[model samples]
Target: MTLAPVEYAVIEFGDSTVTGDLVPALTELVETGLVHVIDLVFLSKDADGTVTVLELDDLPEGTAAAFAGLEHDIDDLVNETDLQVEAELLSPGTSAVVIVWENLWAQRFSDAVLASGGVLLDSQKVPQDVAAAALAAHLASLD
Candidate 1:
């Protein structure tokens, strides 16, 4: 099947528990058909710098149940190397969730581009702070 672009993000909760609070927002994205969850993995680093990786089944009963709805059959797309690279960014006593998702909203556009023989040369996500600064500058210029 033709697929849309897939992207992954690692969200870190410094020195905190991985509460399933973000589940609702994620559920909304999926339910809205904006994106499809490819894989999700949880990681934590202890005070001694020991890293632990947890899949859905490895999470606590409550946490696991909360995240259960987000799971799809497309698993293991985020491998050990991917987890390790993200884990290195976590501080001791911090936890993170790595989520890989298909940009379902862009599927049609991507398919059309392919059909037209167009190629994607590059893509980049601007940092939030930089985007905010640029917006502020533009607003100031308009004043």
Candidate 2:
């Protein structure tokens, strides 16, 4: 089977809690076949900067239940090194979620490019702040 482009993200929360508020949006993406969740891990950093990785069963009952249905295609794809890197970015009292996903909708385009002998030499994502600033500048210039 052709593989889609995979991406990972670390989302930090101000506090040490997983409220499952994003479940609905995530479910919608999966339901619509836009993306497939590969792996998801929750982590928390204590006041002393100690990081603890939490399993799904370790979450609050409601949160655990909310994520129970989101299946991972491959487990532990986000390894210890990945977690350590993301943990360094979290504040002492904060928590974070590390998610790895495949862009399912891009599979067809990727396959077509490969079939046509096109090569992806490089790819990069602009930082959110940078992209937002660029958009704002472009809009202002048009005014």
CA lDDT of each candidate? 0.89, 0.89
What is the overall TM-score of model 1 with all chains considered together? Answer: 0.95
Clashing pairs in 2: none
lDDT of 1: 0.89
Model 2: residue 84 alpha-carbon error in angstroms: 1.3
lDDT of 2 by residue, 4-102 (tens): 999988889999886788888888998999999999899999999999998788888999899878877787888889888889999999988887889
RMSD of candidates 1 onward, in order: 1.1, 1.4
Q: Which stretches of model 2 miss by more than 4 angstroms?
A: none
The TM-score measured for candidate 2 stands at 0.92
